[model samples]
Target: MKKKYVRLISRAAVWSPRFGGLAFLILLFSILLQRFSVIDVTVFMILIIISACCVVVSLFFAVKALYSLWVYGALGGMKALRGIIYSLTTAIPLVLFWGFWFTLPALHDVSTDIQRPPTFFRTARPSDALPLKSVLIEQAALQMSQWPEMSGRRYDGSPDRIRESVLNVLAAYDWPVIAQKKFKGEEDELYIETVAKSFYLGFISDIVIRLIDEGDTTFVDMRSASRYLPRDFGANAAFIIDFMEALDTEIALLPLSQDEK
Candidate 1:
């Protein structure tokens, strides 16, 4: 009878996919839990880091197994391939996240008027509300340089009309309004506070839009800040830009009065 032979690389290759698959499942579960609010952001972040480490380990073993198979005629090529594929399943999103983390500015708070950002009516927690004055003037300059188009918008309409259009745009985007204040007099500004949730991760961001009455025109300023993370990966800036564009479109679609036309 011939003796059976099994390479150590073959044994490693067989276990690689199992570890890879477990890592993938953990990544998925963490995301789902975070999205559903079952777990807090801290726990979700920790789970993600653990899953990422597992993926890296699984990939390392899978590659070594493939190298052994090619150079020393080891077995389990298919299993090694499966491990590689499984590891990549979780790796792609993590890679994209890290890419954003490195490429974008480290800013959790973004505003059209950095010097006097619109204040939130009520924060989810006291610690979550960081005063804009606390941010350095250099950071404000950096934000302006990076997002030149993020300045306030001046619309050729009354504050009331502009506020209507702004609310309509927010509703269209499904950003739920938590608090609002209507303009009563020349000294009062129209303020709307809302919360936006990320499409995929469901991360919460507090948003505030303020409309100042400037005689025949209205000046609108918006601010967005992440609830948990110190870095938002440019999410707040992107959201403000998108919301401004949508508001612009909504205002454009409004019919002109006979005197205005």
Candidate 2:
């Protein structure tokens, strides 16, 4: 019961009009608050994007003023309203800069579920361990009656394990894939997608699973990966770990380097 309450409170922290608000006032207020307070982000990362853009704008204008002394004679140059213009110009940069800073505490605090980097595990074949794609497909079909498709099958396992499952599934199939293949330094990624009328069903997890000797976006980058993970979709924390475990047992995983831990 205590654990349940903790979970409930953690959830309720973001359970507000701030996260679900659709009106202009609500959105504006959420953004403004997110500039300082951690937000419950359920939608596309409007908060981070907005804050970043604001920070950049503030920084740009502030930096631009530095050169104005020589180029435009301090920007407020000898005008009748020079005093007012100078003060306002100076305030603009301060406001924007502080806006980003104030929101730092909230923005910097990310869920531990997403705080880890991808670990590398090298694998040779799908049958060598477990067929990851088949597992999800089987489970989804059994549970949701949906078929999970493979994006690739180059059977290299990483600590990230998401790609391991992808490679495992692709290895199981002889079907021609519409997705890109593994290049010299590039590794394959696995995405399970299902679209329905009520809403869209997708396994959007990604990571750069560094392959042994092969490297270059081995997994999807995290900056935008929030779409599939708990951060964006509020998914189960154990999903990625479970996927990785399934891959480990079904497929071969050899660590290229020490695991990220």
Estimated TM-score for each candidate:
0.87, 0.23
The C-alpha stretches of model 1 lying farther than 4 A from their native spots are: 1-9, 67-74, 126-136, 182-186, 258-261
Off by over 4 Å in 2: 1-166, 169-178, 183-210, 214-224, 228-230, 233-237, 252-261
* lDDT (CA) per prediction: 0.83, 0.33
- For candidate 2, the 10 contiguous residues with the lowest summed lDDT are 193-202
Quick one: best TM-score, which candidate? 1
Model 1 per-residue lDDT tens digits across residues 170-231: 88998888888775674568899998877778777888899988888889999888888777
Writing each residue's lDDT as its tens digit, candidate 2 over 1-261 gives: 355422111212122222222222333555555433344333324543553344344334444444454454453222213322333444454465457445422111111123332321322222322222211222222222211221212344342454544456434432222233333324343333211110122323222222322232233321112222232222222333333445445655544534443
Candidate 1 achieves a global lDDT of 0.83
Cα shift from native, residue 19, model 2 (Å): 22
Q: After TM-score superposition, what is the CA distance of residue 38 in candidate 2 from its true location, in Å?
A: 29
TM-score of 1: 0.87
